[model samples]
Target: MAAELRLLLLLVCWTALASSRCEFPAIFNFGDSNSDTGGLSASFGEAVPPNGESFFHGPAGRFCDGRLVIDFIAQHSGLPYLNAYLDSVGSNFSHGANFATAGSTILRQNTTLFQSGFSPFSLDVQSWQFNQFKTRGGVAYGKGGVYRELLPKQQVFSKALYTFDIGQNDLTSGLFRNLSIDEVKAYIPDALAQFSDVVKGIYDQGGRSFWIHNTGPFGCLAYVLERLPVLASQIDQAGCATPFNELAQFFNEKLNQTVVRLRKHFPHAVFTYVDVYSVKYELISQAKKNGFGNPLRACCGHGGKYNYNMNLGCGGKKKVAGRQVLVGSSCADPWRYVNWDGVHYTQAGNKFVFDHIVDGKFSDPPRPLRLACHKHI
Candidate 1:
């Protein structure tokens, strides 16, 4: 009788693992800079100095001091490091691909920096990728290949987890250009709705489970405060603009609601909200409450006071008047800091966020909607 009971327990555990929606064959990512690996470098631009100096010690094409959160999560989930979609050299989508670009938005109007070619992760690009995977035959191998690869080795990502980290750049651009807070607020719900539609598009193309990361605390980011005068007077020390943060919270709340609604629309789909807003809030609050000093300060920055620039990047030298001058500065310790510059996070900072996601702290496990996204294999 004891042996029979033990057999029953094993069967129950196996059943639970099989039922989770995340049990996909592999992961495919979409969204913007927060998850971008090398998308920005694919485009022509003035090279920023302080980008990617921490772990790789050079511009490895990331906007951070080291690996971004997506890289870490992929590693933690026991998958190969996600390759940038444009990385012709080593990206193998036999598992999946990342089409996220730096500074991409769901809506074309939300584009911030690269205004000339301002194409949000428009349906066009997503469709293009889908088509490419179905044809290109090289690194851009077709979806048929992915399907074949997975059928045999489905266990690798039997519960494939997707990660989307975008939207900050969109909001940042409007706020920096002196747009009214109310104007930005008005656009957010529409953005969330558009973003939700994009996710659903992916689902229609064979995606099973998804983890949608809400936007971070844009108000607390140092760049926003420095760029917006009104924010300086209101909540400058916090490094985030108060109105922006509130807008972010508002958007996230609505985003969660949208995710809830999506669950009803697609009952078989497992949608999870990665609450980056709260995770970031905790990091900054802890930094401030402990007087960490330089909470708002970036670990790598050029210039002083109001005019910080990343153009000079860390450890670079510039020549002026026949003499060389250091173009940028790096913090004494990157692990202790959060903001990499006015735009990104340190490796340590991302690790902290990862801890929260895997453990399900400060919120319920499997998210409130509770779809079968991350079941054990």
Candidate 2:
């Protein structure tokens, strides 16, 4: 009886120790403009001024006036902000790298960036880049000098947190292609299949923790609202386009189901399907209550019902009263508005989302980010 009791105690202790919170040494991210740090900018010049002005104080390759949610995630993990995997100048890969780019999609598009304004570096390409980084980083780390200081250790690949925030562009691409809502909805499974493949690829590389964010409420975005003229009757109570939001919800539902399927496939891996759509929609719906205003308008664009012009980006100039293209300007208070440039969120909005999600209430398994490695029942 004494021996049995000792064994039982040992098992309990072991279980407690084994199930403790995960200590992720690094984070490997893949996504679109929502989580992009600098991939698009590095490949296609700077993000322009007025962007990165709030926090970074200059053009820093980010679409927002300040940091993004991925930036907050890195800071919270006690690691430096991830360098863009494409950023060749003065990049430090000691902790991790971001492969997200503006206008990226889960499924690769057959169009060019100049033609459609979509990135060629889709999710699969990002995954390929990560593989290269891991493989090359190992070679460099083995050199044992400046290389060791600049790159991550070989073991960080398996122990790092893998975050994904793509899929919004996948929806938008279909819209731009003039596909109907049902048509866009029809292709979600394929996009999600590609997404799952990427996740599985990481798992194959020994990545065990996954954090995936669903697409946000694109219906509330100024770019979508102005570019796509919807019928007045189709507007929701929240003043958002109903068709687009419904499609986003459908994509999110299918994405959640995909995560469930992925969990079964990789028993050793822990998948956290974050419901960012709900959080974003809630914020937009109750913007005043959340201390934000003009949730649907862009803070840094001009000449539109929603203060957005597709041809004129945040820093792009537009002629006013036949004068020089100087009417385009940013809002005086970016923190007061939710939409940054009619596409991405402002730093304050990103901070709000980070605050709500870090505690894991927005996650499927209801476990904090620190405990994301543990599989829940």
lDDT to native, each model: 0.64, 0.88
* 1-377: candidate 2 lDDT, tens digit per residue: 99667555644543564557678888999999998889999998889888988999998889999999999999988899999999989999888899999999999998999999999999999999999989888998998999998899988888899999999999989998899988988899999999999998889988999999999989988888887879999998888999899889999999999999998988889899899998999899999999998788888887777788888878886567877665557899999989898888999999999999987778886667777777764
Off by over 4 Å in 2: 1-19, 318-325
Cα TM-score of candidate 2: 0.93
Per-residue lDDT of candidate 1, residues 1-377 (tens digit): 99667555644654565444233445667777778777656654423545666677677667788888788767765667666676665556666667777767766754444553334554336546744653443332234555455322323332455567767766766665677768877787777777777777666655667777888887766666665645246664555567778878877787788877887787776666778788887788677553344556777777756325645544557898999876666777888887777667778778777777654433322342123364321
Q: Model 2 scores what on Cα lDDT?
A: 0.88
Task: Report the CA-based lDDT of candidate 1 relative to the real structure.
Answer: 0.64
